[model samples]
Target chain A: MKEFELIRKYFSERGPKRKDVVLGVGDDAALTRVPQDKLLVVATDTMVENTHFFPDASPRSIGHRCLAVNLSDFAAMGAEPAWASVAITLPTSDEKWVEEFSNGLFEVAEYFNVQIIGGDTTQGPLTVTVCLKGFVPENKALIRSGAKSGDWIYVTGSLGDSALTVASKLNKINVKAEHLEQAQRKFNYPVARLAAGQVLRHAATSAIDISDGLIQDLSHILNASNVSAEIDVANLPISQAVLDSLDEDSAIEMALIGGEDYELLFTVPEEQKGYLEQNATAMGVPFTCIGQVRGGDSGICLVKSGQKYPLPNLNGYQHFSSEEN
Target chain B: MKEFELIRKYFSERGPKRKDVVLGVGDDAALTRVPQDKLLVVATDTMVENTHFFPDASPRSIGHRCLAVNLSDFAAMGAEPAWASVAITLPTSDEKWVEEFSNGLFEVAEYFNVQIIGGDTTQGPLTVTVCLKGFVPENKALIRSGAKSGDWIYVTGSLGDSALTVASKLNKINVKAEHLEQAQRKFNYPVARLAAGQVLRHAATSAIDISDGLIQDLSHILNASNVSAEIDVANLPISQAVLDSLDEDSAIEMALIGGEDYELLFTVPEEQKGYLEQNATAMGVPFTCIGQVRGGDSGICLVKSGQKYPLPNLNGYQHFSSEEN
Candidate 1:
């Protein structure tokens, strides 16, 4: 099929229909109406073949993962995802692959009420770039720079499962057969904590999504807020699947430095802690208090059983680095 | 260098800064404010190595072209280009290349008053996708579906320059040295008819930017508006450089079917012709009337000296087709 037909059949005809979209796929540009008195939030993310996913990865997972990563960013900011523009570059035009890929993409879009407004499909190595546009009420956005001293830091859901899956795939670790399925599911279909972010926006002082592991993403909040944090190593939320697959130390390391965790990491001031506790059920995920924000320069201190825990040698994922996936 | 550092050095610290941007670059997502009573217009375009440009093409031109294509879409919509989110995938972090590439990107951004609000830098084969967001007054956007029968078809500036350059490079045509330099310049730097689009908004019933040749893009307008068109082959605004190098037949062919023109093709109704003519100088480029819209099923006819002009066998570019760049 031609590029125009492929796009029309796969993308333009498939995604969630939105009322605010004045014009959608078949135009020079997509025209949308921003709700009155709402601030517009924008996020862009790219997933490349080899670096971000295996060449043999499922098309559905690839499509889901690309949009999920960008949604994760919006979740951190307490924004409501409204529309997306996807640009996909592929080596070949496989009809089945495009069908399954659009299915996965539209599944997520429908669930999140996001409209696939416009997109561009081209010929090249496999790469997917999603640019998401959303909205937030004025002064209600959760920013990385808003954490305050004495705030209790919390993370949504368990960690290390996705990282453990990746480690196992790389042969750096081994997983038991019983836990492999759950771990693979965690890695392939990360659920963005959008509901939790919206709930946290009312109480959390600041928030960030865990894409580059706990430590690295937390460091962004710390650096932006000019504060430090002390995380209790024993209190880390390591999933049962991850714990069953590796030793305690290895699991902790993966939880700390292993990337692709699409969970939310947030901080709550002392006054809002009770409010968060009361409304925690509305967050739509299991919550855990892992640490406390400290005054002073940016850094993270790990505490294990009353003593300072030594930092591990593992590094968070970074694109263009020698150790990239 | 790390992905974050590279992005900070090349993209975050550069580009035009606008007052509407509440947050930019560093955070997981960007926050921006939309002016009251304005609607948001979005356009996305991607350029990949080998498919869109040669591997040895200058990074500067690649950067400029990637953003310019998107800007051209906004120009066609008669929208004011404001913010852009760029997603770039690269094989390696060549600092010099990045510096020059950002230079070209920022050069266009600054000239057009567009803010580089956020971006993603990933590792892969070179690909750049730009999603641009701008604003158009409510109900003021020039849409392809608005054309009416008897509307005069017009195009901004000259055509066939870029395609002629590509043809010469592919050894499909020969050009004199005098014309070669001018053709290369036209191919490298396409000036999106932004001012013309905005000026034509009041006068034009419909508009589209010619990317995949004049015929293919005009067909889009015809299909959308449920109209047909009749082009006067002798009246096409072919550039002197193109005519100087090729025979009249070949030059007309190039003008009709050559892609990557980036010029605006629009329709002005009989009632608006006086308005368009009065405001022509303010459009920032010369325009020529070459055809007229007709009431019928979608199709295009060509005429020369009141006789039918034969349609050529040449096809416009399409991804995944056998005849691709």
Candidate 2:
């Protein structure tokens, strides 16, 4: 398909027009009106073959993951996604792939009420980069530097299922049929905790999305907040699917250090703990208290049976690390 | 180097925190405060190796062009660039290439006062995509649908030199040393007409950046505006360097349909022509009156000596075109 025709058929037809989007895709640049009292949150994420995804990964999964990861950033900032642009580089212009990819992208975009504003298509290896623009009230954004020493650390939803799915795919590991599908689905369409983030904005002091493993990513929040954390391994949110497929120790380790979960990890003040628990229940999202923020040299630790144990130096998803999968 | 170390050494160190940027890179995401009265202009462009640029092109030039093309999108919207995020995919972590690329990116970014805020890096075939976010007064953005019949069409700077430079590079066409350098520079670092765009936002009825050659890209504006245009071939702006290097016929054809000249092509009211001309002169940017918008006729024509000639039917830079460079 020609570039213009491909764009019109797939992307241009998918997004809903909004009043704030004065102009959208098919223009040289998209025009969006930002309300005077709001701050704009912008973030970009790129997925590449053999790096962010498997070479043979489904196009739908790729598109879903690309936008989902970016939305995770918005969740981190306590912002609502308003508009997004996708720049896709492909080895070839395959109509079926484009159709599926656009469907995947628009599925999530429509859910978030985000307009597909602008994009570029080019010839190259398959890579998808999406820039998401969101809006938040002034001074309402959650930042990594706002956590206090006495804040309680928490994570929404379960973790490690995506990592387990990756392992199963790579080794062709045969697990219980239902558990296998559940793990794979979690890997393919990890949801960004946008609702939880919106509620936590009022109570959380610091926030981050788990793209890297929980331990490493939470370390970023700790380091930025200038505090240390002690996460109870038993309290870590491990999915039943992960637990069914592996031993408790291995499942807990994966939950702590496995990447691509796309859940939000945040810190709430001690005084607001009750309010947070109540609000989270009202929101219908599970929240687990895993640790407490403490002042000192900043690092993460694991607590077991009321005894503190130093965590291993194994950093999560360092890109260059030679750690075995 | 590790991914985190590489990110800190290059991207994190270059962009200083600005007032408008409430939060910058190094966190989970960047947060910025946008003026309430302004419309936010957003654009994304991707450059791929052996596709957008030559495989052997300098990393600095690659970086510069990557950012420059996105800036051109902002220029098309008549917006002042405020912030940008870059997502790069590389085959491997080459420190030297990353250094030069980051340097080139920062040079133009600093010049334009655009802060580099957040981005993602991954492993893949070499690709760079930059998402530019800018601010413009609400209702002041230049749109492609604003042109009307009888409007005067104007372009900033000469066209086709960049295409000629690409030809020269590929064929090793040895022109005058100065001409070769000028052509190469044009191909490498075509400046986005940001200031002219800002000034023309009110004056120009419609606007677009000439990326896919003049004839093809102008068709987009015409299609969007529901108008056609008539060009005076004799008055086409061909730089002396391009004319000196190629025959007049080839030069005219290149100027008409060659792509990658990051110049502004816009339409203004007939009454505002003199004002635009004077403003261009004051800004030290060239203003060439080459055409006039007309009723939609489904085609562009060239008028020479009061005789109309049908323009050649070369669709600009079609990826599937059999003419493989």
Candidate 3:
């Protein structure tokens, strides 16, 4: 079978039925009606082999991660994800790989209440691109330009474990079996903090998803909002699994500079801090106040103990880094 | 710099200013407010290296083709394209490639009056995925399933030239240089029939863009509309350039099975055919009647010398054909 026929036969099976979708795949274009009271929030993310994932990574994990990362984008914007279009390119049309990949993708999508509305499948080196279409009330989305001076910065969940898992997988680092599994799962199935984001809309002045390391990703909000931040090094959230596998210093470094955590990071005004703490407690999710937004300087700073120290030069994952070569 | 920083520095430049674009790139997700009175149409297409284009094709052409194909999908639906998001994956972050690609993408976007709303960039083998969001009046859009028996099938411009261009390029066939240039241009930069599609909304009963060759793509309408078609083989609009490059039989075959023409193939009611022809002529484009829809075996057939015959087994372009190996 040719590529189009293969797609029509195998990949063009019935997607999740939804009232929002007027038309699905196999047509010239998909048609969906957005509710009148909602604004559409759109985000796209692409993952490549060897750079975003190991060549040996299962197709199921790749598919899951592809949708997961796009969902993270929706989470950052405080949007309720509704529909997604996926474009998959492969070195060849390996039926086994495509079957597993689609299964994994649909599995994750089902949990998030998202449906595969449309997509394209083609031949090329393995790549997955997902464009998520979500909805939020008009003028209620969290943006990266709203942070103000005196707001408290918060991060949901722990960070840096995903980066450590990458290193362990690549450098063959030995660690406790339980720690390894937790790290691997964190790397593969990082949850998007959609509930926290939606809840924080009224409180968060600015928000961003932690795809890059905390320091680098937080810099995006600072640059966009024209504010500086002072993070308490002692308050950085490091998971027990990561802390057990690596020394305290290493865990701190990873927590500060590791990327791909997919956690929600935001700044809430001082008046809203109480509301946030209560909400986090009700949800049973950790929301640590790790930093404070400040005027002037316009960058991130780390305060260790009573002394302020300049951070080391550590750029997060560049696509063409010499270290990778 | 990391992939995120590079994207912010280069690809995050402002897009065309549009009132509909509530938020653009540089944010976690782009928020757009669709006009309350209009319906949104979404389409996505992915182009892969060596599959969608020549290995040596410039990044500019790749970007242009990527957006153009998605726009063609919008054209088929008679939708007014408003915004697009592009997800690009590259093996390495070459600054020159990014510059050219963005330039080519925005050039077409400007021509079509669409805004580059948002997208993602990552490290991977070269692949470009574009998702377009367009709008039309509620329940006033054209679709493939609206064709009825007795509708006259029509196509815009000529066909079969793109396939010939591909063959010529691959085999290094030395035909007339002008003919080859015309053919190659049609293959690379075929225009989507946006104007024709929009104007024909009232006249066209069913429509589709000819990306998968005329016979095969038209089969989609037949299958969806539950009708058969009788196409006069002699009436196919074959350009002189394409005719000169091959014998009459081969030219007919090319027109029937050649893909990537990107022209509009549509059906009009008998009463509206005259209006369509007059409108097309006023627009300075050719609209040729090639067939008539009928209720029969629900398949396409060809009429040669007043005798009906089943078309040959020349399927349209399939991406995963074993013959490629």
Best by DockQ: 1
lDDT of 3 by residue, A1-325 (tens): 4565666654566446678777777678877888998888899888888878989998889888999988888888888998888888887778788778887787888888787877888777888888889799988999999999999999999987788898788774556888889888989877778888888887799888888778877887898899999999888888877788888777788888788888888999999988887787543467889989999855888887867856756743433421100
Q: Estimate TM-scores for all models.
A: 0.97, 0.95, 0.95
Give Cα-based local distance difference scores for all models: 0.87, 0.82, 0.80
Which digits, one per residue and each the tens of the lDDT, describe model 2 over residues B1-325? 8877888799887854578998777776777888777878888888888888888999999999988988888888888899988888878889999999998899899889988888888877899888888888878888888989999888888877788888787784557888878878888887888888888976899988888888887888898888899999888888777788888777788788878888889999988887786786543478788988989666687887689855766844555311000
Task: Give the per-residue lDDT digits (tens) of candidate 1, residues A51-116.
Answer: 888888899998888888888998899999999998888888888999888887887898899999
Instruction: For model 2, give the TM-score of chain B.
Output: 0.95
- Docking tier of model 3: it is medium
In candidate 3, which residue pairs get closer than 3 Å at backbone N, Cα or C atoms, i.e. clash?
A3-B318, A3-B319, A3-B320, A90-A124, A318-B2
lDDT of 1 at A93: 85
Instruction: Name the weakest run of 10 consecutive residues (lDDT summed) in model 1 chain B.
Output: B316-325
User: Model 1: which residue pairs collide?
Assistant: none
Question: Model 3: how far is B103 from its true place, Å?
Answer: 2.6
Q: 1 or 3: which has the higher TM-score? A: 1
DockQ of each: 0.55, 0.49, 0.51
| Candidate 2 global TM-score | 0.95
